[model samples]
Target: MARAGLTLERLTLEGAELVDEVGTDQACVRRFGVKVASLYLHVKNSQELKTGTAPLALEELADRAADALAGWAGKDALTAFADA
Candidate 1:
């Protein structure tokens, strides 16, 4: 039900930035310059947007952890993961 110019990926990225700026409490559809009705075409609501964005952030974190720990061992890997 997404609009022609909008997609879930774009909404998720924008939602993530909104969450960063004002925390989840203030990341509303208006922040993305879209009508509430239009927003609902892509996401059921603000909570759904946040839900979709969460896994993207987690995946990015995991990738960074993997890269940071690539060839390190033991304490070094632990330190790298922690630092990442």
Candidate 2:
């Protein structure tokens, strides 16, 4: 059985973390503490995990940028968005 609380979303988040820690090439189940077989249940391979993480990162970026741009305009909004 899959480990308690283990899910694809968790794995994807961990995988993104691994990318930040090690690099995309090293993002894997073992790096994040999971069995290869278990990871396969959610992702076809490490590449798929990496692909899945891209959207997560993009969403987070969009959220931060939106928050930064809130209540601002013109140069101020541009600066905030860029900083975000």
User: Which has the greatest TM-score?
Assistant: 1
TM-scores, all models, native as reference: 0.68, 0.68
lDDT of 1 by residue, 8-79 (tens): 778888778777788772455666676778788877777778788889789889999999999999999999
User: TM-score of model 1 relative to the true fold?
Assistant: 0.68
Q: Write the per-residue lDDT of candidate 2 for residues 1-84, one digit (tens) a residue.
A: 657776777778888887778876355667657667777876677777777799988998999998999999999999999999
Candidate 2 residue pairs in clash (backbone atoms < 3 Å): none
Per-residue error for 52 in candidate 2, Å, reads 1.0
For all predictions, the C-alpha RMSD in Å is 2.9, 2.8
Where does the lowest 10-residue lDDT sum fall in candidate 1?
A: 25-34
Runs in model 2 deviating more than 4 A are 1-6, 25-31, 34-42
Model 2's alpha-carbon lDDT is 0.79
Give one clash count per candidate, in the order shown: 0, 0
